[model samples]
Target: MKAVMIREFGDPRGLAVVDLPVPVPAPGEALITTEAVGVAGADVLIRSGALAAYGFREGHIPGGEIAGTVTAVGDGVDPAWVGQRVWAFTGTGGGYAEQAVAPIGEVLSLPAGLSAVDAVTLGSSGVVAHFGLAHAHFSPGETVLVRGAAGSIGIMAVQLAISGGASAVAVTTSSTERGRRLRSLGATHVLDRSGAGGPDDPTGYDVIIDVVAGPDMPAFLDRLNPNGRLVAVGAVGGQPPADFGTRLMAAFQKSMSFATFSAATVTAAAQQAVRTEQFAAVDRGELHTVVHEVLPLEQAVVAHQKMDGGEVFGRIVLLNSPFH
Candidate 1:
């Protein structure tokens, strides 16, 4: 089996394609023939050694999200899943291979009419969007302000918020063209961060989903309604200012809640359920996964570079060229 392994974390170029023995399913696990894998920001962080303090094991594969067909099932796993197409959230990393073993609980059958590419694109991003909206306890007629609206997770958040009966205000750094794309994805209003008004004046929102943290946090907190919630998913712009105390005090005084999410803490069952729901929405034409580009597995380096360069507007999938 061909796999992209990070023998030493340093840069995207450090990911090396090497031949390795195909992974076999362990107890309660299933071996999947990798079809499509989604590249995420965490993967890039892991590769660049920025997350080295977190103690990720060396010689590990880097992908966290994958969709493929099951080829084998391990002891305690039902053989019925063996030929089923499934999507999985491999939290620690192992999806960037021809064949990867995933715990049965982490895998979900692909809902009718969802393609492998789309399924992979949804990955953790879709699940996180669902969780964030649920955490905010949004209701019909409520309003949501989503930062990084043109990105994968942002787009998913926009669609999910709208589906949950909330109005979505998406903020993006992309051009007017991309803002139109976000609007088509269910954003009631698309605000360009690079434009005149900026992200600060997000008036009338009951909830704010800030995927791009840093200075935007204070701006978003200012826009939140009393008793509203702010869900922080990513910090694209380095770290927040050291004097974030003022904003924290404001949130407290306003009775607003601040929360964060990561796939590591999200249970497998929850992810599977969200995946199922998202797929159903896609089938019904109520939800869509925006895939910006697809590259062959061997071109994984290019995909990583694109993501790191902030050039990708949505999910970038790596296809298992050898298996295809």
Candidate 2:
């Protein structure tokens, strides 16, 4: 099988397409013939070795989310799953290949009318968005602010917040077109992070979903309502403030709380349940997976390049196209 492996940690250039033995499913697992894989910033960070502190190793396959079909089921796995189309979270690696292995219990059967491409885009981001909204205990009629609104996870967060009956306000860079796109995804308002029209008055929002952390932290903390909850899914801008004192003080003063989500923090069962709900939402026409582009698996390098260049609007998927 051909897989995208980070031979050395550096840039997207380090991601090499190489031949590797197809993995067989172990007990409680199933082998999936990969059809599509979602490319995101996490893949770039892993390739650059920035996430080494998180246990990501060099020479590891770099994909984390995938959509594929079950070809075989291993011992202790239900035989009925064979030949079923499913989407799964491949925690660390194994997604950027012709075939990947996932625990049967971790796979979610694609809901009616959902395609592999769309399902793959839901991946970890959608699940995290769901969890963030759930953790916030968002309710109808309340407004939630989503930082990095144009990002993959941010976009999903916007939609999830809306689906949960809350209004979404998104903060993004000076990209009017992207702001419009986010509004279409359920964001009630869009603020330009690069310009004067910034996030509105602090303490106005019921929940703050911060996907980018940096100098904005102080202002974001100020904008939270009393008892507001902030969920940080990623630090697209940079690391969190070195002085946790100021941020913690602000949170305490406002009676606010913060939470973080990572693959390690999510269990297999939870992933499956989230995928099922996401797929159902897609099927019910309540949520849509916005795919910006799709490239052939062999052109995995191009996918990484697009993501690194920040040219991708939504999800950039890798399909098994012969053109690659």
Candidate 3:
């Protein structure tokens, strides 16, 4: 089998393609013949050594979600899964290869009409958005603000907020073109990323789904309406200032709250259910899946470059050849 590994950190060019023995599924796991791998911000973070504190290291295979066909299953797994098209979560690694193994519980059958590329794009991101919204205790008719609303997770947050009956879906994006695309996806207000929030309407957003958290994150706290909730799901911009919480404290009278969310907090069963629901929604046309481009597995370095360049509007999927 062929795999992409990090020869060094801090540069996308550090990603190198090499050959390796195919891995066999362990107990309660299944081996997937890789078809499509989602190139995500986490992959970029890992390759750039930004996630070193989280245990990512050189020689790591940086992929989390993949869509493919099941070629084999381990003990305690259903044989019927073999030959079935599915999407699997590879935890935080092992997906930058021609083949990967995932626990049977993390594998899901592809919904009818959902392509491998689309599945991988929407799989883990959709689950995170779904659960992140829930973590904020989002309610129908409440206004929502999705910060950094350009990537797959941010895009999913915008659309899901609208479908969940948000009174208005506002987003913070980097460019006019990106903002335009988000508006077409049902965003009611498009604000500049630096602006941090919408116009000063005393009644601000009832919920804020933030992906970018840095020194600027404190600015959004004031944008939340009284009793509003802000959930930080990603920190691509790095951690906020140590005193960032002072804003929430200063606004204590408003009863506003701030917290962070990770899909790991949710159980595997819940995550799988949300992924399944999201896939079905995309297949049924109630949801949208955005894929920027598809590259061959060997071009893993190129994929990381696109991610680090910060211009990709959505996921860049890596495709694997069946012959490999």
Q: Which candidate is the best by TM-score?
A: 3
Global Cα RMSD, each model: 2.4, 2.3, 1.7
Candidate 2 vs. true structure, TM-score: 0.92
- The runs of at least 3 residues in candidate 2 whose Cα sits more than 4 Å from the true structure, single-residue gaps closed, are 194-203, 250-252
In order, candidate lDDTs are 0.80, 0.78, 0.90
Q: Flag the better candidate by TM-score, 1 or 3.
A: 3
Q: In candidate 2, what are the lDDT values of residues 211-271, reduced to their tens digit?
A: 7776666567666688777777787666767774477574676777777766566677876
After superposing candidate 1, which stretches have Cα over 4 Å from the reference?
194-204, 250-252
lDDT of 1: 0.80
- Highest lDDT: give the candidate number: 3
Question: Which tens-of-lDDT digit does each residue in 1-324 have in candidate 3?
Answer: 889999999989999987889999999999999999999888888889988998888989889899999999999999999999999998889999999999999999997699999999999888889999999999999999998889999999999999899998988888889988999999988888865444552247899999989889999998899999999999988889999989999888999999899999999998888888888889899999888999998888888888888788978999996433
Q: Higher-lDDT candidate among 2 and 3? A: 3
Worst 10 residues of 3 by lDDT: 194-203
Clashing pairs in 2: 202-223, 203-223
Question: Native-vs-model 3 lDDT?
Answer: 0.90
Tens digits of lDDT, candidate 1, 195-217: 23445545657887878877656
How should the candidates be ordered by lDDT, best one leading? 3, 1, 2
